[model samples]
Target: MFDPTAFDNIKFMIQAEVYDRDLAGLFHVHSRKDLVDLATLSRESVITFSLKDSADLRVSLVVKADLEKLAGELLPSSNALPGVSLHILYFGTERSLMAERMDLLEWMWGTERRYERKKIDSDQTGTTYEWHVYFERIITEEMMDELGDLISFIGESLRTVTETE
Candidate 1:
């Protein structure tokens, strides 16, 4: 049986290169107070943390049981175990930029994008796009060993790409 507490605490890290350094400048243009206000107004779910070197940005998503509904379909009925799902999302300055990067990553991993939508800022009228890649599987005793490594490998691969680019 999977520990619910452990699952609740699990956070996945995703890293991507910021090809255009000017994006960082955009953040600088606004004051800290203004930026906070913008973020509050924007209400973006994905929070970005940039490296000092300006090479890449890291985004973290906490695994939530409520968001695992789709994964539940793949669970075996014989067991009472709850299913876990992995969600990967990408955001960019432009809609096309986000879509193109998602396409390349999905192709490289052989995974299809699941939920995709444009998030419009109600107050500012600005737009941001999100592409969600989901993997669903039932947790099993034997699968536990390989599962950790698989997750780690995914995180490392993303980080490696950011480092190399």
Candidate 2:
């Protein structure tokens, strides 16, 4: 379960970096109060926005520098060094990939051995699933707290995950 409210916190930080040029710089977000160690966020501006469910979004960001290494691989045009603006497109690619893999795995391992409620109903309706992912800001308070825990865990710890059928 992913809380949509908690998403605001993450999306805000990202959007702030993209639209506001002055917001560009090296920043390290830490948990509890550990200025002792940090990771410097690369210096550059970033733009981000969410779109309607049915609408496809195509966007671009321009910056002052010609060296474009920081701008991401959005365009083939060589960019200025120490690039002024870096653009990252978030078109539900992450959530989609996660959903896709979950579907494939469940499909491959028919709903027999790993038994549950004796039935699994696949539907286009969003309300039917026990666990769901959303790009929209629709979350509960408990889920928000859970999200915080997940962030802290993921932020400070790094681990490798290997998937096998």
Candidate 3:
């Protein structure tokens, strides 16, 4: 019998929530990837989706657990905590909306998470802006129930972004 790691459990839960939304016609999943690095023994899951009402802005949810976190979960003597990092990515082309996005993010997630905007050069759009939402602390299994709320926030955030644009 193989016991799943904490990262696997959380990833599955997140997928279930996102897929349910997709099935409900609220969101359209764009891409999904579950990756494992053999050399580093790290695990990562990335899922991107767009709101059914607006495909212009896409939201990506990323979950990651490094080797230390995995070892801490599986080994009893390991001192490292079994914590996973969560990130929300927003993709858009309007740089002028930076202030609005910042306000929306602050209103949705407060000041707990860090935010960063990066500029990407593109042919289709003069420049694309990618917003990253990073959790200040790694998430543990104890906070699993909050995952659904996180998904809901993403959905609402997408809708808000579309309405403003």
Candidate 4:
């Protein structure tokens, strides 16, 4: 029998939730990548999407699991367990209100996650910003049920940050 890793399960759950929203007309799927590093024996998956009405802002959900995590789950004597780190990234040209938006995201994601914003590129016209929300702890299979709520919160965050204040 073949078994799926925690990373695989979580990635599928996230994709299903996002694609469901795409089908319902709330969001549009842009790009997706599922990669495995043969040398490191690590896995990473990224899914990018945008709000239905706004294509400028791109949101990406990334899930990654390294070899140590996978080995821990596969080996019965290992004390460590398998898990994936979840990161949500936003790309857009909204420099003026970035501070406020970061604050709003911090509040929405709470204190467990670390947030960072940096200018990825800039030109005379405007600057492109990338905001990343990194979940501090490893997300295991037990936390699978939170996938839907996480997607919902992300949607709420999109609305909150883009709205005129």
Question: Which number leads on TM-score?
Answer: 3
lDDT per residue (tens digit) for residues 1-165 in model 4: 779888888999999999999999999999999999999999999999988887777899999999889988899888877899888998887753377777777787788768888875556756787889898888999999999999988888887777735
- Note the Cα lDDT for every prediction shown: 0.39, 0.28, 0.86, 0.86
Q: In model 1, where is the ten-residue run with the lowest total lDDT?
A: 27-36
lDDT tens per residue, model 2, 1-165? 743222234334433443332233222221111111124433322332222121222122211122233233234564522223222221222333244434543454345424121122446533221212222222222343343443223222111101312
Per-prediction TM-score: 0.45, 0.18, 0.92, 0.91
Clashes (candidate 4)? 0
Residue lDDT tens for model 3, 1-165:
998878988998899999999999999999999999999999899999999877778888999999999889888999999979998888866743466775776677787678887878878768877888898887998889999998998998787767764
Please tell me which model should have the higher TM-score, number 1 or number 4: 4
Q: Which regions of candidate 2 are displaced past 4 Å?
A: 1-101, 104-132, 135-137, 140-143, 150-161
- Candidate 3 regions with alpha-carbon error over 4 angstroms: 95-98, 123-126
Model 2 compared with the native: what TM-score? Answer: 0.18
Ten contiguous residues with the weakest lDDT in model 4: 93-102
Q: How does residue 76 of candidate 3 score in lDDT?
A: 97
Residue pairs in candidate 4 whose N, alpha carbon or C atoms collide under 3 angstroms: none
Residue 123, candidate 1: how far off, in angstroms? Answer: 3.8
Better of 2 and 3 by lDDT: 3
Indicate the residue-level lDDT of 128 in model 3: 76
